[model samples]
Target: MTGPATDVWTVMSTARTIRRFTDKPVDEATLGRCLRAATWAPSGANAQEWRFVVLRSPESRAVVAKAAEQALRVIEPVYGMTRPDDHDDSRRARTNRATYELHDRAGEFTSVLFTQKRFPTASELLLGGSIFPAMQNFLLAARAQGLGACMTSWASYGGEPLLREAVGVPDDWMLAGHVVVGWPQGNHGPVRRRPLADVTYLDRWEEQAGPTLVTEAPPS
Candidate 1:
């Protein structure tokens, strides 16, 4: 287990979203640890309405991959479009390109953790507040073991019906997302982000705080 002395900040700073994974196998014991961490996350009123279904068999992965491809076909066009403001064109293009690349490679990972939750009624729009944190906890736990993972909501796009039936999830449950995990085909490194000052605000909007996200210099 990773201790407090392990510098969680560093672990968090370098935990980039990994899409291209190697052929290395992730054992059951390792995945169980990640699930344990996920269960420790706080949920709305302690309801903990989350459920994780692990997909390992090639046939199962193929189903998910096909569903994801359908989702990409529907979503990629939106990402490629020019936003009304036009200021986000470049970012949109990059995202579109990444999704395009990830489409064909989705099924090749070690495992896909299917995140699901009880269906939320119109009154409970905040249901995601409980499930998303658990997903993050699982991701960070995998990162601690030098594994790579990425969370994708493609399951909810156009393939939700097919995926729900294939995964054998009941109608009362809704898909939260999918987390694909495995060893990386490439190295893990720091993720790019805006400077903290640009995003942080003090007591009021535009009242900025000092940067708290710092990284050490690389060896020469």
Candidate 2:
């Protein structure tokens, strides 16, 4: 962790959402390191309820891909229902294209699904509050090591039964989502964001006088 402040900034800025990836496999040692980092994430009452199911084998990955595809089919129509009437047709076309590409790429990526044991609403929020930060830490650490990843929840739609069966998860477990990791196939660059003034409010919850950058600089 010892480094110049600028080095930290560099790492943060370089972390981006990577969808495409190389075919090379992530080794055991690296995977272990990432999992170990996840263990340090904070939890409610120290009730660290997070569980990870890593799908590494080709067979297992295929199972996940099939389940995810089934889930996406049920979800796509629902998504179409939520769009505005004025939305561009080209945008929808592009989205549909990306959906297929993501599906095809999914089987080759390293997938890890997260879960938590059933709990009351408050406890569930606390568990999520604890787990998500750890998940971010894991993603950032992967980025620092030149790996790329994206978090996706599309698999949670109607795929829960299949996931539970495939992963042998207990009846009381709740599925949070999945994260895919690999060496990115494309470039990483600065992301587009809105100016800060639009979203931020001053002491009285009103807009401030200065121009604001909408997106915070990517986490370092």
Candidate 3:
């Protein structure tokens, strides 16, 4: 952890949402390091309510994978119901394709991390504030160890009782997110993003500031 090899910015910048994985398993020691990194994330008033469930057993993963598949079957139509005329067909189709691809390979993950924490109180906005940072830490730690990872909430939101019961999560806890981790099948690289100047604002409203060349535009 003492060289450019462990630089924080390098790790953060290189972390990507990896979906495809190889059959190699993640060793127990590496898993411990990732979880330990998550524990160091800050929490509200140090309440530190985040909890994680790791599934490596094929039987258990199958249960969750089946739930994810069932969930995807209904997502597009559910979005249409919620938005009606405003639903974007092209965007929805793209999302559907991505969801299906993940579902097809769900069982390949060497480890699946289920994140949960106490439900937020009415007074608090962004209830996931405490939990998500910890989840990010978990992913970054995995990335640093040369493992690929991805985080999503389809199981929590769409799979519902099936997923909850399979994992034995309590009703009092909200499912924050899920992360899939394993050896990547391909090389990793920096993801595209909007130029920082286009997204960042200065002292005045609508005023663009910061370096304009932070990233290149995605391919058209």
Candidate 4:
């Protein structure tokens, strides 16, 4: 298949997380392309035991949405997320509002439940090295298709059992990640990042590679 109509660098730069979606339908072909990209991600021992479950039916999505609701009880407090004052219009406030919308409507969007085979010798973190790259590919592929997407921590946030049973995932597989995909109700632009040099280090951890701009300084 031809590469997506977007440049690689452009896709990477613009592939920001999207939460709110319209009622527009997402076709199977588009999703298949994203999954195809996912299969190309590297895995340990070339033991590609990753499995993906597509949750599109209203019933399945409702299951996820409900779990998301339960998850927020833990997430909001730990993260210190307070309801943004209606008059507040800062970047953090906007992000908070979108995040809340996602939690409320997660089940209404098409999502994928990614899982990896569990082995006696492999810890979940070790297995994540095998599976997360595939999820990255899926995210990039979705962006290339001009679809919006974001990885969800609903499972890790205490929704794993409900999601696993709802999707009938086998016990031998660990729930690696989950992502929501759909036509975006938002815009995609250059992703915000710290100056590369500040984040990147040279040969030694003690060495500063570049001028350290105060990361928390107010934007000019």
Best by TM-score: 4
lDDT of 4 by residue, 51-121 (tens): 99999998898988987898778789988887788999999898988888889888788899999999889
C-alpha lDDT (0 to 100) for residue 106 of candidate 1: 72
Scored by CA lDDT, what does every candidate get? 0.71, 0.69, 0.69, 0.86
The C-alpha local distance difference test score for the whole of candidate 2 amounts to 0.69
C-alpha lDDT of candidate 1 relative to the true structure? 0.71
The lowest-lDDT stretch of 10 consecutive residues in candidate 1 is: 211-220
Global Cα RMSD, each model: 6.2, 5.6, 6.8, 5.0
Clashing pairs in 1: none
Q: Best lDDT goes to which candidate? A: 4
Candidate 1 segments exceeding 4 Å error: 1-5, 81-101, 113-116, 119-125, 210-220
Clashing pairs in 2: 12-220, 194-214, 195-212, 195-213, 195-214, 196-212, 196-213, 196-214, 197-212
25-85 in candidate 1: lDDT tens per residue?
A: 7889888888898899888788888888888788778877887789777775865532234
> Which regions of candidate 3 are displaced past 4 Å?
1-5, 75-101, 119-125, 210-220
- The TM-scores, one per candidate, come to 0.79, 0.77, 0.78, 0.89
Give the Å error, residue 208, model 3.
2.3
Residue pair clashes in candidate 4: none
Give the least accurate 10-residue stretch of model 2, judged by summed lDDT: 1-10
Model 3 lDDT tens row, 118-145? 5546333455787778888888898888
Superposing every Cα of model 3 onto the true structure, what RMSD results?
6.8
